[model samples]
Target: MKKLIIASVIALFILTGCNKDKDILNTLNDYNISQQDKGYHFGDKLNIPQDVLDYAEAISISFGDKETSSLSIDPKFFSLGENDVTFNIKTKSGEVLQQDATINVFAKAKARPIAYEIANQYPHDTNSFTEGFELHGDTVLESVGLDGKSKILKYTLGSRTPILEVPQPSNIFSEGITLLNDKVYQLTYKAKKGFIYDSNFKLIKEFKYPDVIAEGWGMTNDGKNLIVSDGSKNIYFLNPENPSQIVRTIAVASNTEAYDQINELEYHNGSIYANVWQKPIVLQINPANGEVTGILDFSNIAKQNTTNEDDVLNGIAFKGDNMLITGKNWSKIYEVILK
Candidate 1:
């Protein structure tokens, strides 16, 4: 009887061990681990599901191949652009269990509205297809576009006549112009090429556009780096030393939707002012996170200046306390102060 009792106790112990293992496997199988499809900006901490936390002791967590503890996810693991991070769960014994879960990450920021007013007005050339406009000292440097009509012109604030003009090659359609130090950088439309010229309109060198951008649409500088825009929702920060290398990318968006066709750019007072292509509204963007914090309504100006359908508001420049804005074939440059 004593032997039989000992044997029965041993059998019970074995059965309990097997049940525990089975329970652990069943718990892992039944857990609903799904990929997070929502967008998260940089500096945001990801919230792990409570269910996953409950089983944290039995499994390991990781983003892609980088192993992580049961603690919250760190956003630093992701890149500046769109990212797909694979999340995996493994047994404490180092056996893989689930690896299908993923998280979609976006480097974006929340946006708020900014306001402005029409402070003043100035004269501009009606024939200038203004693609790029900037005020260097008291001179307005403009880049005009169109296959056969592309050129760079330098004019005074109140003058309609260009003090200097440099015509582009007949095949190259100039898009945007930016002056950094004593050099002027000009981008082409679809040629995938750019020009480096002196402030006096002498061509110094030519560079190919970075492969990341589809085409050049706008360009600006923040006293440090060159900020560029392709007609897409993205804005690229390029290294001045190497214009083809992209330093970073920001996806522009409003509170409700992403803003694409982001044309002519100007960096002023710690913000990026962008003219949306074919749209009369200028978006005030936070360069750090690509958020459209303000919308400058140019609809009235567009309607008042419209001589043809091809003419759209496309120029932005800062002079003293006012902003200079104009369009293709525009006869006047409107000066406005932001409230």
Candidate 2:
């Protein structure tokens, strides 16, 4: 019995000695370089010169990294301030890096609207990263992001309860979603594919579309043509019959020369309603000239929902006489009736 105890102790000591700490921390390179600013907007192309990448590993930092070398892009927090973002970029060996390059974020400055007075607010499921939302009477159709977990949820207005959910295709990252003539049209992120679903949520058809639109962020229809946004400063008008042909393209107008990430879109009456990805404002755009006529500031909406994290505000639904707005990680869906 004593010999057996001694052997067990030896084995335990050897195992503990061999158990070393794992060194494989997630490197900045492990993440797809293309996805660095997926949730935010930047220039049409990075200005990173070959000389810049020659020596240092190219990394992005958000304003949250102010204390450490890490970087973050919390839209609700840093995006509210000037064009500065805070984040961190640590190396494979725990080394931190920085460029001190200043980024200019362009968020509209407007008065915060009262949560109750601005529009109707509905509690949403936090699990849903709402990308697109549309309304059929009191019924709301929503597009949730992140491939495996993404889905189309049908909910009742005012009540904010999802009554139906349709899973997306395997390996497909669902982005924008809209219904026209009883058929649902959905866009995939960077997949260059569009899916068509029937009333029963069955896959009817899958088609290829433009890849130049910068990840197919949002989609909507104007009864005659399909309008889409790509997290850029422009909106695309395409022929629903033939999406390959660009019918028209409209650049979202802002007071400044900066570009805003136009994520979700809805066509109400004759104007285009777009949700600027990380901002608290919604622009009322003129379809004819692509001019922003009115801006609805809902800063108070975020203040009321203090429990939510810094999320991407991307969902917009327009029903008959009512409008609905939701965010990527928001806990509620708001039924907004603009006064």
Candidate 3:
């Protein structure tokens, strides 16, 4: 009887050990670890959870399918925008586990000085407090700002006289304008309303803009969607069919830091170019990641065109292969080929 009892006790111990091992395996299989902040900056030390380390015999980190541990959040990884880092686990026998973990990687701002040459200059209206500018063939469309003076005007390339003019409500302060399909969409500064007009510059509808932005500053369309800035670091993409709905938001950043006061946007050659408010630099930004790929210094243009401190550089438009830029209450419009 004593021998049988001891044998039974030994069998119970073995069964308990097996159950413990099975529980560990079950926990490992179900474990899903993520970065605490949902994003890691460039050069930030990669953090591996202690629990994850204790369970796995070998661990490998990868961006997409390629191992990124060696890159260490370098430029190559950052330039690709947000990335998913997968943690692959292996068991004691080098058997791949069923469960894997993923973390998000974000880029740290990096500055790149872009070069440009003045290809030509054109005549622009001095009375126009240019907030939005766009080119349709040889003609130019502009949205002039200020509470009492707000209006949308279409002008011939070198003429101060407008071909067509549409006035906004005297109380509504107008901001940016963009052309989508056969319609014109315009933003207001603080009213949280946007105006839509036909190709002939006649008001067809007025819709409420999204409240995600504090104030409207600039707007442009990328063939499919409308991109808007609100005098902040954020740029929002909106569906044309549903103007109030935001498709996504991109936070503008340089190599070392994030930037604010992004205004007067223009989409050209697959890049979003914006004027940083009150600054003499135009940022060539990547739409996918909000990375400032290049900085076009407009100090020369600003210095040559400044009538007063209020007349800051503001307008940007694409005309064929050249870019047309102007400012608030300033004289000439510059047509330059970015080199």
Candidate 4:
């Protein structure tokens, strides 16, 4: 009888302890973060409740690296879109507690829609799945994609046929191309290989991509360095001498949303212009910081060439003072002046 009573008392004690732990967890979970509306912006201060602040001895927050109790709202640490954050706390009892959070950052100004007028239309080969495009002087340097149909073409402006064509191997899918320092650099989609050619189309060498670039989508040169996009919000600048190395990366975003599928890049004047895959819009992105300052919508221009959804806008090139744009299997390219 004595042993039975002792065993029952021990069972009750365990149950009571479990219930107390659950109640404490519930109280902590029910604590509210003192923010209204959506989330914190660049200038907004983060508000932590007094009770919650009192719950931990030391709290550290970070999006990439944990800063020692600072607000961490520095523009360098936060992007314009959603940021996944980690919170580490050193408790009074010497226990370490880790928590996860999400904070959406907004741009300072909304991206404005840039109006444009079509100056002229030039013939483009319908057979070409336009990927990379550039206009240097009176010549057009373009790269087309597909496993067997991928190739690079050099032609004069307003011409439908290429003066020089270099076909890629049947097994590899070619992607974006950029011309820098009298050399042509071409990217492959998934093969992890890239090619460089002389100004006269002679193969100079081949190189492999680093793991940082997953899939090559668009490429252009910002005067000195070659810029590349891997179908993501991030745009990478590579060393022209060493194409395999990444020098810097910037995430593209607007006031309301983050952008991906950044295709067909072209650097003009001081900004980086790009075409988003499957969309008839071109974003004029700030190269220094990845803010999408302005947008060029070509819904009317896209309808002129689009027959199906696959033939989305995918090309951008600057000619003199005009912008030359075309799409996948687009019959004609339009030269428009951005206002």
Clashes found in each candidate (C-alpha, N, C closer than 3 A): 2, 19, 5, 0
Number of the top TM-score candidate:
4
Task: Give me the overall lDDT of model 1.
Answer: 0.78
Which lDDT value does model 1 have at 218? Answer: 98
Cα-lDDT of candidate 2: 0.66
What tens-digit string does per-residue lDDT give for candidate 2 at 143-173?
Answer: 8888688788888776656788888767877
Candidate 4: tens digits of C-alpha lDDT, residues 146-254: 8899999999988977899999899878899988989999999999979999987799999888798999889999888999999988899999899899998888888
Off by over 4 Å in 3: 1-110
TM-score of each: 0.72, 0.63, 0.71, 0.85
Across 179-206, the per-residue lDDT of candidate 3 in tens digits comes to 9998999999999888889988888888
Total residue pair clashes for candidate 3: 5
Model 1: per-residue lDDT, tens digit, 141-217? 99999999999999899998889998988998989899998899999999998899998999899998899889989
TM-score pick, better of 2 and 3: 3
Look at candidate 4 and tell me the lDDT of residue 35. 29
lDDT of 4: 0.83
Best by lDDT: 4
